[model samples]
Target chain A: MSSNKQNEIALAAVKLFEQKGYRATSVQDIADAVGLQKGSLYHYIASKEDLLMQIAHQAILQFNEQLEEILAKEDTARGKLEQMIRTHLIMSIDNLETTTVLWREAFSLGEGPQEVIQGMTDKYLNLVADILRSGTETGEFNVTHPRITALAILGACNWVYRWYHPSGTLTAEEIADIFSKLFLDGLLAH
Target chain B: MSSNKQNEIALAAVKLFEQKGYRATSVQDIADAVGLQKGSLYHYIASKEDLLMQIAHQAILQFNEQLEEILAKEDTARGKLEQMIRTHLIMSIDNLETTTVLWREAFSLGEGPQEVIQGMTDKYLNLVADILRSGTETGEFNVTHPRITALAILGACNWVYRWYHPSGTLTAEEIADIFSKLFLDGLLAH
Candidate 1:
């Protein structure tokens, strides 16, 4: 199988899955999008679920790679948190279709793939929590519950996908700055 | 048509919709859940989409009513914001199944009902933004871009449905308090 053809098929799948939903989108629709016959499409992938898992896995890998780079930085926890939010926003907006499909369709996968995605999500949550815990210990942050706080911060960041658009007034960087300020300094005037 | 039976049918639909995606669930499945014949189920709802609209409408109505009560109070913006978070948390957790269905499946409705839910959602976002704007004007809150801030705050709150559980260590009120504090005060040590 040509890797180029596989990549093209994967991209087409994400587009259809995001717009029509994973269940509503059919394998033939994806094949049509990529200018391939339904039978020929199988040359690159086993089934629709296989294509979905590939896209979902790729999304998570990209997220984890970016997060790992941010974690490797020797900045303070606050700084690293800001970087995490910035990276998340940039990636989410840039890959909006893929992100949408991953969030919306990953659960529809079989148990093994679902568990794989869920496990990656758990690790992502824990890494955020670890940052909060370190900040608290270093007296840089005053969080009472690191895990819950992490969830709130990430939730705020993730929800950007529902509204962010390329033509929107605020760029990803601007939104990231706003979120970082909101999380780090809060709404209080003090 | 018996309102009691209608209510039972609606409740069962919410449960099934939450467990199974709206597309995958059949009218027959909903009827089976409520011990009603498929033909009889049509007596209560015009179609599966109609049932979804009813549930989604009720969810938005409950949210709006709670928010109105909170807004009617003459509390300070800080106090009201805290109350808003608390009210949202409690209501969301209490109606977990309904909320799950609303968030996940409401968009699958036909354009008309989808518009209705979207309109209500826009109004809700505007109301939250209004509070932030007033708070900023009153010099009680230091928010910049109230609309964006509102989205972030609500996003954090709404994402609670993804992870929250009755068996979790923290109750809804405790989680609400934590979120309120996080939103109102910076994570950085004062």
Candidate 2:
């Protein structure tokens, strides 16, 4: 019951942070959304920053876990990258609010939480770079700079959150396929 | 003289908004940054939102102007796209604070200003799509969805603001070259 309540509170916070910017949201507002008295809300979380940290931590962990699963696959680098792009698109769409809060409000976190989030972000980037490096070594890919290539791929994937709509013509999977093709194959007709 | 004051105030606001965020920044802070009395600041701008509007408008207009210049160039689609990427990277790095402010705070504007910014954003996207469409028509590019491909390219370029630093090993020109190559030739060994 305790963990369930905490989960409820976190969900409410994510919604509020998405609708109202994090700085504009108050602890009282979060408590009201979660059906708790302002004072009682403290029992579940230490502070507003704590809630922000919780949301960011949860979001990044999900991304890390998904990437790790893709990394452990025995596929070639191109295959793994496609899978990563698809998983990332699906995850971003599935957890749009969480992703928004993490990207928009994580910087508002205090030093310790910010560092933790940054570390996780770097880990994700490094993992992608590792794949690119391995692909180059095995002659599966022609990437010259694995880190920059990783950033470009991730940037293209991450920007989906900004423009994706449920009512849009293409579904997440279709969009992922288009993106995978664009990244894997050059824009040239050849 | 009055326009100069406004320019100073706008630049100061961009810095403050980048450092402290839009909502966290106060008129007093902006006035202080520009060495003006709080009341005197109103002579140049109407409100904090006005300053945000100014910053966003300036940033988008700059982007549009740069893009327009590239669009007018008498080059192939590949050449235009490469120039676009290079110009975008340099412009983004040059105006990092303005770029950051525009992306981070444009949503906070009222309906009218929000719509205006959105329109400008669409205009930029459409211009990019035009290049891709032309490329595909000429058999120079293999893009299926010009709009989506344009978004991917812009996303990769815009994300430079997040990780770019003067002290970094790679210059903006070098990053732009890598991006252009990656987009044009892709990751596969031809």
Candidate 3:
């Protein structure tokens, strides 16, 4: 199979596995979706697990790159937080399939894959934690526990995959701004 | 079937469903887990959908009761927020299986049951939103958009069901207090 054809098959397999689920999806189903024989499809990937690994790797790499870019921006902790929120929303919208798969199946990656994914997740968490820590040090915020705060904020941001609609009323920028203001100043007026 | 027996069956079904899934789980599996014959299980529930509905309803009722009790306490918005946070953590831990099912299969509830569950969900959201609104009105809060802020805060709380384990390092009270402080006061130190 041509390299382009291989990528197409892998993409179709990822979408099917992510949506219909891994156990429910078969190689033949993937082959049928991509208009190839099951036998010919094996020319591209070795197994269903390989397809999952490839998709998961790509998703994590994208998330890491986005995180790095957001952190690299020459901005204050608040600005970085806002940028992180916006970029996460945009990526989730643009990469809904992989994001859904990541959220749903990260636990199924077995020990090795779980560790890799956990490492990525921890790295992501630490990135947000660093911002919160910096915010606390700068006297611009007053949080009691920076680590837990980071976890809560990241949890809120990562969960957009569960409910976000591409054509929904709230834009990415709007959500980022709303989240930033809510977390920074809180609801109670002093 | 006796009412107790029916509930016994339903509880077993929740365990099986959470460990496996709704589609992958069979009525026979549930019956076997409860030590009842497959054919005899119908004496308690009509179908798997019925089992799901019962379990979800029970979980929602438990959550609603907790919220009501918290709101009834003679306290300010800050105290109420702490109550909400603590109760939420305790409920999630005490009813992990039901909470998992609630988070996982919520979108799959049929129309009649879906409406009921959605109503419960809306009530829960409004409960939190009302607290924030009250805080703002009393000059104890600074939230600009109550609806969006409520959703973000609720999102933070709800996502904990996916990753938290009660037996882990943090106790329920500790988690709740940390959540309340982080969300209410934020991460920046003044």
Candidate 4:
């Protein structure tokens, strides 16, 4: 299969898996949804698990790239933290399908897939933890446990994919600013 | 069937549903898991939707009761806000199973059940919004958009069930206190 055809299969698979769930969704379901025969799907992807694993890999890659870009920028710990939060929020909103797949499919992935996703998730999570540590050192952030706080913060941002509607009232930038302000400066006017 | 028996059925159903998900889980699955024959399962509930609806109602009812108790407390907006945050977090953590079902099984509830869940959700959401609004009015808190701020804040708290393990380090009270501080006072130190 062509690369574009493979992407089309993966994209359709992600949407269906997200909508109907991974176990409930069948290859025929994906193939029918994509206007391809069930056998034709095999030409593009090895199996259903392969399709999900690929989508998950793509999601991790996208998140890693986003994180790397933010960290590479010339900025203080505070700036980097805010940028990380903002970029995560925007990417989640923009890539709702992939974001949903990443979260919703975690339990479905077997040991091999779980390890890959878990590694990516830990890397992403630790990146936040490092920033929190730096903030604490710099006297910019105050929290009891940097590791747990980072998870809570990222959990807050990542779960937005479940409810965030692109056409909803709040824009992506608005959410980013609010979250950054909430996470960093908080609700106080001081 | 007796109310006790019905609740037994629902309880068993919740376990099955949570394990295999609502879509993949059937009345038969619940029956077999509970050691009831397939035909005997319907003696308590009308359909799978009915089973899910009851679970949703039970979950939301507890939350509403919790909110009512918090609202009844005589305190300033700041105190109420803090109490609300604590109560919400404790409630989410305490009722992990039902709460998880409340989120994951919403899609399986169909339209009528979805509306019911949505109404309960909106009421709970608006309760937070009201606290934020009162806080802003009394100058106890400062935020640009109280409604969206409420969403972001609640989103952060509500998704805790996805990751929090009771056997883990932080107690529910500690988690609530940490969340309140992170959201209200933020990460910035004086």
Candidate 5:
């Protein structure tokens, strides 16, 4: 089978995993989705778990790249954080199924794949933490715990996947702006 | 079966759902966990999804009562928001298995149960939005979209279930305090 066929199978698997919980989705289900027989499906992928890991790896690569690109810019820590939020918002809206699959089925993957996904998650998480640390060092922020603060920011961003509507009134950019202000400046005025 | 027996089974189901994904956890497994045979388990719950729905209802009921209690206070919007955050943190930490199960397995529940859970989720979500709206009406906030702002705060709080550890250095209260400050006042300082 071609590599393109593998990607096709993986995307179909993601959709199935998102709809039916990962544990309930079978290889045959995936095979049918990709127009392949049960035995032939293994020619392109090792197993269902392997495909899930691939999805996690591919999704995290995009997130890692987005964070790295933003971090490389010569901007304030707050600015970098805002850019990161925007990137996450765009990814969540544009890549809804993959994002949903990543978060929803993350725990179902085995230890090896879970660790790989964890590594990617930690990299993205630490990038956010680093920005907060920079803010504290530069007197740009006064957060008591940079790690907690970073997690909160990412949490708010990730939670968007649960409720964001593609045809909704707010664009991803608009929602990103709302989140950045809420995290950096807060809801209350002085 | 008594109501207490039903509660025991629900808690066991939550634990199983958190450890094993909902679809992977069999009704027999839940019964085994609760020291009941498969046939006896049905006396207490209609089905596995029924038990999952009960957990969701029970968890959301706690959240609803907490929000209402906080809202009933003579506190400011900031205060009410803080109380809400604190309540969430405590619940996430103290009820780790249940919280994790509720979030991780929310999609696995059937439509009728899903709707019930969503109704509870919406009630809690709207309470946060009300706090933000109060702030705006009182001229103490500047959010253009209180609904979005509320979701961000909730997203942060609910996401805590994914990473919180009881033995971690930070107590639930400390984390709640950090979140409260981070949400109410933000990271930037005068």
Candidate 6:
């Protein structure tokens, strides 16, 4: 199969998986969406799990690249963390469907694939924790559990996909700005 | 059906729903888990959606009671928001299985049930927004979008079920304390 055909199948899989869910969306559904028979589709992709793995890998590739670049900087921990949040929000907004599929169906993947996806997630987690720790070292952040706090921040970002509307009042940039400020300054008026 | 039997079915339904998901879980699975035949299970509940509606109502009842009490108090907006965070964390921790089901599967519910759940969620959101608004009015908080900020905080709490472990070092109380403080003091150390 040409790389273009593979990309076509993968995009269809992401849309079907997001709409009907992972279990409910069969290989046939993906094949139909791509205007091919199931047999022909199999020639382009290995299996349903393989489709999911492909989509997941595509999403993770972007995530790893952005985070890797962000971490390479010698900026303060707070600066790195702010950039991390900004990157995360941008990625989630740009790839809303892919992000939804990865967040919702990644857990249902087979152990090997689950571990692969999880390994990517853990890298993000650890990067956040590292920033929190540096903040403590530099007296920029005070926290009892750097790890849990990191999880909370990521959670807030992931949960946005559930309610974010494209035509909503707040643009993605505005939403990201509000999130960073709310998280950084909190709700304190004084 | 007796209330005890209904509760038993609801409990079994929640567990099965969490493990197999709402769409994948069959009525037979829930019945078998509750030690009843499928025919007998229908006598106790209207449908699978009914089972979910029951569970959601239970969760919402507790949520409303706590938020109502907290909102009625003359406490500062910051204090009320903290209490809301604490109650939310405690509820999510104590009702882990139910919370997981509610967060993950509640959207699959029928229009009537979905509206019901959304109504309760909106109440919580409005209450949080009100607190944030009060903070602004009293010169106690700074926010560009109080409603969005409220959603972010709740998202953080709701997403906890994905990663929170019972064996984790931080107990629910400690986690609540840390969360309340983190949202208030933020990551900045200065």
Best by DockQ: 5
Q: Which 10 consecutive positions of candidate 5 chain A have the poorest summed lDDT?
A: A181-190
Per-model TM-score on C-alpha atoms: 0.98, 0.97, 0.86, 0.94, 0.97, 0.95
- What's the candidate order when arranged by decreasing TM-score? 1, 2, 5, 6, 4, 3
Per-residue lDDT of B47-127 in model 5, one digit per residue for the tens?
888877788788888989988988888988877878889888898789988888788887888898898888989888888
For model 6, the stretches where C-alpha displacement exceeds 4 angstroms are none
The reply for model 4, stretches above 4 Å from the true place, is none
Give the per-residue lDDT of model 4 (tens digit) for A38-152: 8887888888888888888888888889999988888888899888888898989998988887877655777898799888888988888988888889887786788778877
Better of 5 and 6 by DockQ: 5
Where is model 6 chain B poorest over a 10-residue stretch in terms of lDDT? B181-190
Off by over 4 Å in 3: A10-29, A108-111, A137-141, B72-75, B108-112
lDDT by residue (tens digit), candidate 3, B24-117: 6889899888899988899889888888988888888888888999898899987888788888878886788888888766545678997898
lDDT of 4 by residue, B3-33 (tens): 8888788888888777777877877788987
Model 3 chain A weakest lDDT span, ten residues long:
A102-111
What lDDT is obtained when candidate 2 is compared to the true structure?
0.89
Candidate 6 C-alpha lDDT tens digits along A114-189: 8988898888788788888888888888866888888888888888878888988888788888888877877786
- What tens-digit string does per-residue lDDT give for candidate 1 at A26-138? 99999999999999999889999999999999998898889999999899999989999999989998999998887767767999998998899889999999999999999
How do the residues A1-190 of candidate 3 rate in per-residue lDDT, one tens digit apiece?
5889878986897788667766567899999999889998889888877787777878887888998998887888888887888888778768888887777655545678767877887788888888878876886666666677777887777777766777778887888888877777665565
- Superior candidate under DockQ, 1 versus 4: 1
TM-score-wise, the better of 4 and 6 is 6
